[model samples]
Target: MTRLGNARLVLDNEIRPGGVVFAGGLIGDIGEIGPGGDGLDLEGDYLIPGIIDLHTDNLERQTQPRANARWPSRSALVAHDAQCIAAGITTVFDALCLGDIGFGKARNQTFEDAVIDIAALRRQGALRAEHFLHLRCELPAEEMPEMLARAIEDTHVRLVSLMDHTPGLSGQYGDLVRYREMRRAEGLAPAEVETVIAELQGNHHAFHAANRALVIAAARARFIPLASHDDATETEIARNAAEGIGITEFPVSLQAARAARARGMRSIAGAPNLVRGGSHSGNVAVIDLVRENLLDALASDYVPGAMLEAAFIAAAEGAIALPAAIGLITSGPAAIAGLADRGRIAPGLRADLVQVRLHEGLPVVRAVWRGGVRVG
Candidate 1:
């Protein structure tokens, strides 16, 4: 048994200064402690639930820092897991892109292989943080259906997102000229870039229709949650809802976010958007979504530390109470991923907790516990 005391515990909808006890990987008790027990005092810092990261591409970036520069899968997974734990992320869904857009660093079968390798490592208990797969499927990819089918076969595949980044279709890849420049920077020949663009344009509609069917079918078959990424229009939200996607990730506009909420779907905005005060891609600001009561959760799209930082930012901005802000990184994401346990400071919940110390108005992780054991 482990007892953590002298901290403000962020529980459901409130923050209470109390001690939390854990035994056998579950929260045993939570209340005031008056000595006479083995306890580790946190000296009145904040003790919040271990962060749950729903969307992170850090693993993919670690695996392939540069184009064609592939690192060993096990090494990359270990490094990514360590970084997540150190950043207070107890649960992480590694976002792996599945697409044949003929652009970007990860645009081939190598990505699929990397996902498989990560799953294998997780099954072997080689990963420090609890890892799951978040397959980012490009709807315009011709082979996405087959890839989705294969990925769903893995029990670790917890979430799937349908993405459509075709130029002129979704504003996600906003400017085609910028896309062309990026491709050129990646060393794509002019002829090859034109051919790929033509191919993407030619098959955009058909691939979108086919991939949507595959995503819906896979979600049902695997009982995995489905999300629509970069929704820019109300029609897109309606279409996603019709296909049974209950999560809208990073809607490009307020209208799309409102439509998502109307359809009973959770609207997830990137934590980076909150920290940076705006979207890097010039999309909808997460603070605006929070103000409008349209935001349901915050995802660490690429920055693991942004989860906690965004929560504090939300609290400081009066967008939500401290506990509610913390929920955006904890219970909200756990529930979205169907993780019924953990994410709360209550008995019988998994003892996934983090001790945070504030430094210059930023939350820094002092310690992390996963399942009653001190992991970091």
Candidate 2:
């Protein structure tokens, strides 16, 4: 058995000084608030459940490290897995886009390569963190149905999010001028930018409703949980709730988040948004939602490290207690993803935990153990 003691245990409801013992990949016991452990000594640091990230674009970032610099798929997967482990994440749902919305033609290729790379790495025992696929379906893309058909066949896919990123999508991206500027910054000529925007809008008008129904049907058929992305209004949230979408990912406004809560849906915000104090795109702030009791979970989104940092930041900001803040990245997300076996410090649960020592008010990850095996 592995006995780790002298640490602050972030339990489901509160934080207390305690220890836990584990063996055979399961927590054998949780006791010993005082010192006297036979194995590892935590030495007064905070010990919490390993983070469970349900949506992250870190794989895509790793796959394309720089502009025009696409790395090998398997190599990028390995690198991403290492990053996740170091970030104290035990389970990660890699959010990959299935449909190309003209801005990123490589999304389709990235999705395909990631599926194959994840499987290969798992077979070879090369992954440190548990990896799963979260398919991000762009409803306006014409190829979404065809690509989703191939994607859902893979056993790794566990979640699907419906998105409509048609240029100037009202909620999260209401600034059409900003949209055109961003595309132009990407080296697109002004005329090309306009042309692409027109094409995207046309596709959205033609296929958004039909493709949405198809994606919802496919997800329901497979029993995969559905997330609605960047919802802006109560009506949009109500429509998603009626369609049986159980999670609202990155709600764009307070109205949308309140609607999700009213419908008994989970609301996930980006951890980076909380850590940075506001949304990058000028949407509803995460702290405001926390004060309103509207935010349910926090995902890494693009930066895996933001999960741990955001939890501590939340606690420091006096919005919530440390244990509840930790839940935003751990238990809350795990519950949203329907992962019942991990995400908490308790007897008989998987021993996926993280050790952190706060330095200058910043949580620093010191160690990580997944299923009772030290990985970082």
Candidate 3:
């Protein structure tokens, strides 16, 4: 048994200064004003639930830094897992792009294979953090259905999202010049860029229908959570909800977010957007979503540390209460991912917790525990 005392415990809906006890990998007890026991004292620091990250592309970045710059799957998985633990994330859904857009390094079969191999390694006890899969389906890719079938059948996929990046369709890549610049930075030749764009335009309609059906079928068959990425319009949000997608990730406008809420679907925004004060892609501001109470959760899309920081920012900015802000990283995400056993500091719940201290008005993680064991 282990006891953590002298901490501000962020409990279900309130913050109480108390001590928490853990045994058998679950929270044993929590009470106010407890004396010293045979465990460590946190010295009045903040004890928050371990972060549950639902969407992150960091693994894909680790797998391929640039075009043709591939790293070994084992090394990348180990390094990614370590980073996640150090960032205070006890649970992570590694988002892998499943498509063959033929424009960047992430469009290759090796990306899919790496996901399978990493899941296998994690099952063999070679990973530091609890890992799951979130497959991103690009609608214009011809090979999307096959990849979705393989991922769903593998049983490691817990979430799947429909992402359409066709230049004019979703407005996500509306700036064609910017898109070309990004492609050029990846060393794509002019001819290759033109060819890929032409192919995407030519197959837009057929690919959209096929990918949408595949996503819905796979999610229904496997009972996996389905999400829509970068929803830009009210119609798009309605269409996705009608197709049984229960989560809206990074809606481009407040109208779309409100539409999602009306459909009883959660609206998720990237934590980095809140930390940076706006979206890097020029989408809707996350703070607006918070103020409107339309946001259900915050995802650490690219930067893992942004999750905790955003929560603190929301509290400090008066956008939400401390407990509500913390939930965006903890219970909110865990519930969205269907992880009911974690994200709360209560008896019988998994002892995934983080000891943090506020430094210059920002949350600084001092340590992390996963399943009653110190991992970072």
Candidate 4:
């Protein structure tokens, strides 16, 4: 058994000074500091549940660190897993893109290789965090349907998000001119940006409905949780709800988030949004969602460490209590991802925990343990 004392335990609904005891990879007890325990003293740090990140594209960033450079798939997978573990993420859904709209052909290559790499690492017992797949399907891509068919059967695919990145249609790039500018800033010539935009619009017009149907059918058949990415309106939320999508990722406006909540769908805001104090894309600020009680959870999105920083930021803002704020990265996400074994400091639960030290309003992970064993 392992006992950890002298820490503030962040529970599901409250935070209290206590300790945790675990054995056989499960929590054995949790309460006040008990007598005669063979464990380490945490020295009054904060003990929170190990973070569960539902959607992170950090792996993609690691794989393609530069515009024209690609890292080896297995090496990138290891790097990604290590970064997640160091960030106190015990459970991570490596969000991989399944389709491309005439750009970033390398994303398709990384997608194909990541599945094999993750499977091999798992079989070899080389992974630190428990990794799962979150397939981000591009609804307007011609190959999306076929690509998804190849991965939906994989055991690691726990979450599937329907992503439509077609400019001026839906999602982050709702304004065509803004999308064009963004592309141009990425070094695409003005003509190329306009051409790419037109091509994407054409793809959306030709393939969006059929691809969305295929994705929905596959997700429903497997009973995996479905998420709608970048929902921008009440009508979009209603359509997703009618299609049985229970989560709305990064809704672009307060109305859409509120509508999602009204429909019993959880609204996920990017952790970076909270850390940066606003959305980079000029979308709805997460603090506004927090104030309105429209936010259910916070996803890392593209940065693993942003999850921890955002949780502390939310608490510091007084928008929510410390425990509830922490929940945005812990139990809230675990529940959303259908993981019931961890995410709380309670007996009989999986002992996935992290020790955090607060320094000048910033929270830093000091140590981490997964299933009663120290992993970081």
Error of 4 at 209 (Å): 0.5
For model 2, how does the per-residue alpha-carbon lDDT over 161-188 read when each residue is reduced to its tens digit?
Answer: 9998888765555678888888898999
lDDT over C-alpha atoms for residue 246 of model 4 = 98
Candidate 2's displacement at residue 191, Å, is 1.1
lDDT of 4 at 230: 94
Q: On residues 1-376, what C-alpha lDDT tens digit does candidate 4 reach at each position?
A: 8899978999988888889989999999898983345778898899999999999999988889998899999999999999999999999999989889656798899899998999999999899999999999999999988889899999789999999998888889988888877888889998898888889999999999989999999999999999999999999999999989999999999999999989899988899999999999989999889878888889899999999999898889998888988898988988898888988788999999999999999899999999998999
Q: Estimate each model's TM-score.
A: 0.94, 0.98, 0.94, 0.98
| Poorest lDDT segment (10 consecutive residues) of candidate 2 | 31-40
lDDT of 3 by residue, 82-177 (tens): 888878999998888888665554545555666668768877988767888888888878888877767776666888888888865565776677
Model 3 lDDT, residue 361, Cα: 94
- Candidate number of the best lDDT: 4
Candidate structures ordered by lDDT, highest first: 4, 2, 1, 3
Task: After superposing candidate 1 on the true structure, give the runs of residues whose Cα lies further than 4 Å from its correct spot.
Answer: 34-37, 104-110, 177-194
Which pairs clash in the backbone of model 2? Answer: none
- What is candidate 3's TM-score against the reference? 0.94
Q: Is candidate 2 or candidate 4 better by lDDT?
A: 4
